[model samples]
Target: MKYISTRGKAPALNFEDVLLTGLASDGGLYVPETLPTFSAAEIGAMAAMDYPSLAQKIITPFVDGCIPDSDLAAIIADTYAEFRHSAVAPLVQLDHNQWVLELFHGPTLAFKDFALQLLGRLLDYVLERRQQKVVIMGATSGDTGSAAIEGCKRCSNIDIFILHPHQRVSEVQRRQMTTVVGDNIHNLAIEGNFDDCQAMVKASFANRAFLPEDRGLVAVNSINWARIMAQIVYYFYAAVALGAPARKTAFSVPTGNFGDIFAGYLAHNMGLPVERLVIATNRNDVLHRVLTTSSMRRQPLQHTLSPSMDITVSSNFERLLFDLYDRDGAAIADLLARFDEGEIAFSETAMARARSLFSSACVDDEQTCAQIAATWENCEYLLDPHSAIGVRAAMTAGIAADIPVVTLATAHPAKFPDAVKGAGLNEEVGLPLHLRDLFERPERCSVLPNDLAAVQSFMASNIRA
Candidate 1:
């Protein structure tokens, strides 16, 4: 399959090129030239396959020309083998129709593991074949850093660097990233918010003169097509498990970067019979504002119990905008250019089209806590703050009673214990046995200012010599 940039200027590329060249040359995200669709019979047939087998079937079309089938299947099989749960992405029913799709069972205890683990294997395979090295730079509010680092730490060909907002992420989140000892892994605690870290990563992609000429820069964030492609699998897994195509399923996704929900959008396009895609956010709700009021404006990032969703700018929204504009890359480029200057209103036609299949809700900290408390009291489910926001959105989304509403549980409650305690529950959530001694682990990381040059200089000096 061929991938094209959201902006009109970049040359179209195949899967391998898009996998390596994240954030296209023209400052745009790459999307499939044309999406692959599945028939209802095909979607229903997947109900009998295990997670790894189903993953191989779903992702084969996208990577057909790039990786051999046997190689891709092995990579996928080994990826899920790292997850703590045998079910991989399991479903827990809260009520007759309300459900939670448990996605934090992977190594990092966050939904990101579903993608990053696969991405690491893919990178290792591709780089091994070409006998080349690359640099991985990513920004995280909480979960992505640890997951990315864990995924790529074993690779000998890549130097991975992750930046997170200093003192903003939870103790578990920070420790998860900082405690891993590897010559190839570097963590940065930037003295700014998540958006600042994200902007620096984007800027580095735009200008990489500071890096060695022979090395390429890669993205572990959802901007990479590989990450998004990996994410699309769970949506299908959850849907088919609950009977999709033959039955409609709704999803409530707690997203900051817009990548997770955008994958749901792709699943619906791929004929999964998705009833509704709810955009769940905390106080930093640019996505809700854009969907509800047609206003796309930047706001100050807020510190919330759900640190992961405390992002004012949602990056992957541009991919949806590209689709909303009927794949007109020039129009998307112009729209984004104006948006960067200031607020720009979304077109009424596009908003109308979005409203048909999508809905949104903004849950503040109080509501997040309340949801956590209520779910625990009623169903004995301990939800992390991010997952609390998702459950709240799904409960109040006003969908019909027959349709199943699955809230994507983005993180394990143990990752954010303070937030879990803040919900008025005296229960203490403990880390998994593998991370039982996380607090005692010696952490190694650098504290850097939110300046691109400082970060680049640090990366240049710290890379394996």
Candidate 2:
């Protein structure tokens, strides 16, 4: 399957190239040239399959010409074998039709593990075959850093660097990334917010003159097509388990970068009977504003209890906009260029198309805490602040009572003990057994000023020769 850039200028690429060459040459995200759709029988058949089997079925098409089926299957199996849960992405029912798809059971305890784990393995296979060495530079608000570090730490041919806003992420989140011990793994605590760190990563990808000529820069963030491709599996997994094909399933995703929900959008187009897609956000809600106001504008990034969603710019939204504008790369480039100036509004047709499939809600910290408290009281289910935002949004989504709505539990509640305590819950939220000693682990990280040159210099100096 060939992938094309959202902005029209970049050359069409196959899956492997898209995986490696994230953030297109023309500053766009890559999307499949044509999505592989499953027939009703095909989707229905997935009900009997296990998580890995369903993953192979859904992901095979994306990596068709790049990785052999056997190798892909092995990689997938090995990747998921590390997850703490047998179901991988399990669903827990809260009310009659309200469910939370638990996605934090992986090594790093976040939904990102679904993709990053597979991505690290894919990179290992591809780079080993080609005898190439690359560098990974990623910025995270909270979870992606630890997940990416965990995923890519073992890659022999790659050196991974992750940046997170200093003092913005939770203690668990910070420790999760910093505590991992590897010569190839480096974490940077930037002095600014998430947007600043993300900007540095994007700018560095756009121009890599600082890196060694032989080492290409790779993206671990959702901009990579492989990340999004890997994520599409759980949507099918959750939907099929909840009775899809004959019954439509709806999803409410707590997203900052828009990557996770974008995967759901891809699933809908790939023949999943999705009832509605809800965009659940915390205070830094660029996506929420877009769907509600039709204007995509930058705002000051806010630090809330749900630190993972503290983002001003939703990078993956451009992929959806590319489709909304009929895959007109030139138009997408122009719109984003205008967006760089200050703000940009979509055409009425584009807005109408987006609104047709998406409804959004922006929840503040108070509501996030309330949802956490309410869910604990109602069903004895503990929710992280990000998942709390999702559950609250799903509750208010006003979908029919009969149709099931599953909130994607993006992270384990143990990752944010501060949020749990803030919810007025006296019970301690202990870390998983794997991370029980997280606070006791000795962390190694560099505190860097929010400067691209400083980051690039550090990366260049630290890369293994």
Candidate 3:
């Protein structure tokens, strides 16, 4: 399969090149030249497969020409072996048609593990074969940092650096990233919001003059095609389990970067019987605003109980926009260029197409807390703030009672104890056995100013020779 840049200027690349060269040369995200669609019988056959078997089947097409089938299967098998749950990504029913797809059972306890774990292994296989060394730089509000660190820490050929906003993420979230011990792993607490840290990562990707000429920079964020490709599996996993091809399944995803829900969009294009895709957001809801009002404007990033979703710029939205504009890279380039200046709006035709398949809701902290309390009282199910937003959005999404609406439970409640407590529940949400002593672990991190040059300089000096 070949990958093409959303902005239309970059050369078309195969899977290996897209995986390594994230955020294409022309400042665009790479998408498959054409999606691989499954027939109804093909999707129906997935129902009997186990998680790893199904994962190998769904993911094989994306990595076709790059990694050998035996190697890819081994890498995938090893990746999910790190996850604590037997199901890997399990489903829990809340109401008649409401279900929560538990995705935090991996090593780092977040939905990102579904992708990052596989990404780390893929990089190891690819880099080991080529005898190349690279640098991994990523930004996270809360979960991605820890997941990325956990996934990539063991790779021999890569030095990984993750940045999160200082004092903005939860204690567990912070400790999760900071506590991991590795010479190749470094966490930076930037004195700004999540967007600031994300922008620095993007800036570094755009210009890597600071890095050694032999070492290429890689992205661990959703911008990497591999990350998105790995994520598309769970969407299919959840749908087939809940009954797909036989019945349509809907998903309400709590997303900040738009990567997770975009994976669902890809699944829909890949022939999964999807009823609807709901965009769930907290206060920083750029995706919500764009869909509801058609205006894409930047706003001050807010710090809410759901810290992870506190992002103003939805980076992966450009990939969808590329399709909405008939894959016109030039038009996407012009739209984003105007977006850089101030604000931009999509064409009416594009807006109409988006509104047809997707609906969204923006929940504030109070509603988030209320939903958490209500879910606990009614179903005895505990939720992290991010998942609370997703559940609440799904409940009100007005999908028919017969259709199953699965809320992607993005993280474990133990990762955000503060939000769990803030819901007015006296119950203590304990960390999983693996992370029970997370707070007791010693943390090592460098506190850096929010300047891109300072971050770039640190990465330049810190990479192993």
RMSD after CA superposition, every candidate: 0.7, 0.7, 0.7
lDDT against the true structure, each candidate: 0.94, 0.93, 0.93
Q: After the best TM-score superposition of candidate 1, give how far the Cα of residue 165 lies from its true spot, in angstroms.
A: 0.7
Candidate 2 residues 93-147, lDDT tens each?
9999999999999998999999999999999999999999999999999999998
Model 1: worst 10 consecutive residues (lDDT sum): 415-424
Off by over 4 Å in 1: none
Ranking by lDDT: 1, 2, 3
TM-score of 3: 0.99
TM per model?
0.99, 0.99, 0.99
lDDT of 1 at 67: 95
Deviation of model 1 at 139, angstroms: 0.3
- lDDT of model 3, residue 247: 97
Model 2 stretches with alpha carbons more than 4 Å out: none
What root-mean-square deviation over C-alphas does model 3 reach? Answer: 0.7
